[model samples]
Target: MHSFKRVLVTGADGFIGSHLTETLVRAGYNVRAFVYYNSFNSWGWLDQSPEEIKRELDVFAGDIRDPHGVRSAMQGCDAVLHLASLIAIPYSYHSPDTYVDTNIKGTLNVLQAAKELGVAKIVHTSTSEVYGTAQYVPIDERHPLQGQSPYSASKIGADQMALAFYRSFGLPVGIIRPFNTYGPRQSARAVIPTIITQLAQGNRKIKLGAIHPTRDFNYVEDTVEGFISFLESSRSIGEEINIGSNFEISIGDTARLIARLMNVELEIETDEIRLRPEKSEVERLWADNRKARELLNWQPAYGGEKGFEAGLAKTIEWFSNPDNLLNYKANLYNI
Candidate 1:
């Protein structure tokens, strides 16, 4: 394990980013949080984090697309966890140009900065979306990448760029590709939150996109721990590893499960507008997490039937709160 204590976490105000920041701070690392700057000075999810965690973060607001901004934020940090990017698939379809600029160019800026700063380690974030509809049941690192959408294409470009830097410049970087992660503070743009928010708002008919598509859902904490494990493992350098529950569940069944946990009977209403173009929708995804287990000595604490049910129950409770529920517009389709 590398002994660096100060690490920079870009996209620190986001769902997974916020959870990872809290875990890093509690683990005694000096954290520098790079949040997207806005006129409202909104810190997103971090604003809701406990005060103790907030105090430990040296928060910097900047745009990752701009090389100068990313470089400035990364200065003085020994390592970086780059998670800033445009992630929504629907949004990406509407804005492919922005996706390329942010996901690809933004990653280049981080890699260049890390190389110049002489950072010992870097943990770049990737997504399961890059795999498209899984070619195999348990998608391994070697599984062929299919860019089914503009979003996945951009991520594929970004992941390749990171690997190039490692091969060309000998940069010590690791890519952590996480499957669908769900929990408190997840944006309503995600399927889990979309279902939970609608059901919590007392909607009997839940509107969703393709319900038959399956996903491997991991809890936020487990994904965060995977990031830390990758950072600590020397063998992870220059490698790409998956962090997931390795369990697949259809979207339809997941919605029904959430309804049961919420003590409500609901009808799954498929909205045409919510559906992706036939070819663009990824029909299924399941992960082979053995790489992370063997390389990082990490195993998912929240996985399998029992862990998934427990995680969903906790997520349901969070969305059940009026305060959190109000943040979501359950009546309208979010992206």
Candidate 2:
């Protein structure tokens, strides 16, 4: 195991990043959170983190697309968890150029800086969307990448860049390709949050798209643990490992499950605007996390049907809270 003195988390302001940051701090790791710089000075989800966690953070506000700012953020950090990127698929369709700039170019900035600084470890985040529709069940790292959408394409580029850095300059870089991750602080653009938020608001008709598509949903806590495992293991260097629950469920079933858990009867309405281009829609995803288990000795605490239900129950509890539910505009389409 490689010990890192200080870890820089790009996108530390995001949903998964925020959870990872708090977990790392609780585990006694020095974390420098690199948040997107905005005039509003919003630290994103970090703004809502506990006081103790915030007090322990060394927060730096900067844009990942800016090379100088990215380099500056890496100066004192021995390791980096590069999670900053534009992730919304529908938004990517509307703005492909921004996706290339933020996801690809931004990742390049992180790689270049990590190479120069001789960073001990760097884990770049990848999404299961990169696999597109599963041509085969239980996708492994060896699965062929099919970037059906602009968002997935940009991530594919980023993943290659990270691997290139490792191959060419001998930089210690690893990629953790997580399947669908959901939990508190997740944006309504995600399916689970969309369902939960709409229901919490007492909406009888749930708006969704392509409900037949299956996803391997990993809870935020499980995803965070996967990141930590990758960060600590030297065996993960130059490896692209999957972090996911090895279980699949269609979007329609997931919605029904949520409604059942929430104890509300509802009907799913296919929102035309929510539908992706038929060619761009990924119809299935199931994770084969054997690589993560063997290399990093990691597995999701929330795995399979029962585990998914448990995760969903916890998620529902959080989203059901009036204070949290008020933060979401459930009636509006998020993307």
Candidate 3:
């Protein structure tokens, strides 16, 4: 494992980023958390983190789209885990401009800053959505990218920009493309959280769209572990790796599984507003994780069918808590 004095985590206040930050601090790494600046001075999910983890973090509030701020955030850090981006697919449909600014330009700022700063390693986040509808089962890193939505399109642009930096400037950048990650603190916009929050709120009739679409779901902790694996392995440099559970299940089946786990009789109702434009829907996704296993020696603790159920149980337990459930508006459509 390569050692670094300080590692910067962009989007540190977010779901996966918060989990990764806490894990790194617990593992005894010097971490600088770069959170988005807001008028309320909110640190997002970090505000809910354990006191010990909060105390260990050195928080830097800045915008990823600002090159100056990004450079300043990376000043003393040897490596960076860039996870800042606008990721809601539905919101992207409403505002494609914001997605372009946040996803594409935000990544460009990180790339330019990392190149100039001589950062030792950079791990950029990518999504499986870029592989629209998965032309084949078990998508590997070599799969062709198809941007079916504005959100996925922006991410595709960002991923290409990261790769271009690696090729043109020889920047030590690695991309960690994670499949659907769900667990505690995930936004309601995602299908899993939407399903869980609705059921936990005593709604037997769950609302969703495009239930036929299959996804390769990875638990949040597993995704966090993938980030750390990529961060430490010198072999990950210049490589694009997938972090996924290597299992496939349709949204409808996933909802039924959650209902069984929660001991609730489920009735799924299609929410028209939640449906993506016909061609924009990614019908299927299953991961081939052999590359991550061989290159980074990484494997999802939550892998395969049984592992998915176990992960869902853990997620349900968390969302079942009244305090957590109160944060979501289960009665309304998330997007």
Candidate 4:
């Protein structure tokens, strides 16, 4: 595997980004973490990382939407991992233009800068939601794209833009489409965090939307590994690789597994407010992962049951502490 000496990671303040930043650092690569700029000088989750990990990362605060700032961040970096974007589907309902600006336009900016920087590889982040309500089980890279939600639409645009760069300008870009990654430090907006946080606060009953929909969840670490593997593979260039477990479980069953892990028999309640527009709901997402395995030689280390057990243990432990749980708005559903 060819390891880049310096790697730039956009959105390093986020859950998956932070984990990937730390992993890159551990691999002896100098890490430049591009986090959203704030007056507070807060480096998102990087600030919360252990001192060992924090010291290994040089956090650069900037907006991915700005081409100048993105180019500056890419300077001296051998590769780039672009994970910054607006991802909350519910919030996308209220404001979608911002999603387009950040997700689609921001991706264009990254591709342009990477082209100028002569970066070895550009690992672009995509989401499973882009294959909305999968027309077929075990959705592969060739699966049809759907835009049921504005968030998914924006991501689809971004993914298309990334591929366009590769085809038009020969940019060494690979799209890592992760399926429902969940773990510690995840925002409460995600279903896993929403469920785990509710249970952590001693709630016996949980409110959720469209529990019947199934997703293939990959633990954050495994997803990160997929990102790294893609970067190290020559075949991944211009390829859209899926990083997911070849398994599926309904959100209802997922909640049950979490409850079992927590040893709580919580009743699941559906909230109308939480449901998506009648037809917009994505009913099922199962990943084939054959391309990922063939190209990157990566497979999920944790499957559904074990991943749930491990994730719930870590997430519950984090949420149990007031410092973490206090960050959530438990009373209202976060879109």
- Which candidate number would show the highest lDDT if scored against the true structure? 2
Report the C-alpha lDDT of model 3 over 1-335, residue by residue, as the tens digit: 34989999999999999999999999999999999999999999999999999999999999998889999999989999999999999999999999999999999999998889899999999999999988887899999999999999999999999999999999999899999999999999899999999988889998899899899999999999999999999799889899988899999999999999999899999989889999999999999999999999999998989899999999999999999988888888877
- What tens digits encode model 2's per-residue C-alpha lDDT throughout 106-190? 9999999988888889999999999999999889989999999999999999999999999999999999999999999899999
Q: Tell me the spans in candidate 1 whose CA falls farther than 4 Å from its real position.
A: none
Compare candidates 2 and 4 on TM-score and give the better one. Answer: 2
Ranking by lDDT: 2, 3, 1, 4
**Estimated TM-score per prediction?**
0.98, 0.99, 0.99, 0.96
Q: lDDT (CA) for every model shown?
A: 0.93, 0.94, 0.93, 0.89
Model 3: which residue pairs collide? none
- Tell me the tens digit of each residue's lDDT in model 1 across 1-335: 34786899999999999999999998889999999999999888999989999987899999999999999998899989999999999998898999999999999999999999899999999999999999887999999999999999999999999999999999999899999999999999999999999888888888999999999999998999999999888999999999989999999999998888888998998899899999999999999999999999888888997899899999999989999887888888889
Model 4 is weakest, by summed lDDT over 10 consecutive residues, at 303-312
Q: Which residue ranges in model 3 land beyond 4 Å of their true spot?
A: none
Which of candidates 3 and 4 reaches a greater lDDT? 3
lDDT of 2: 0.94
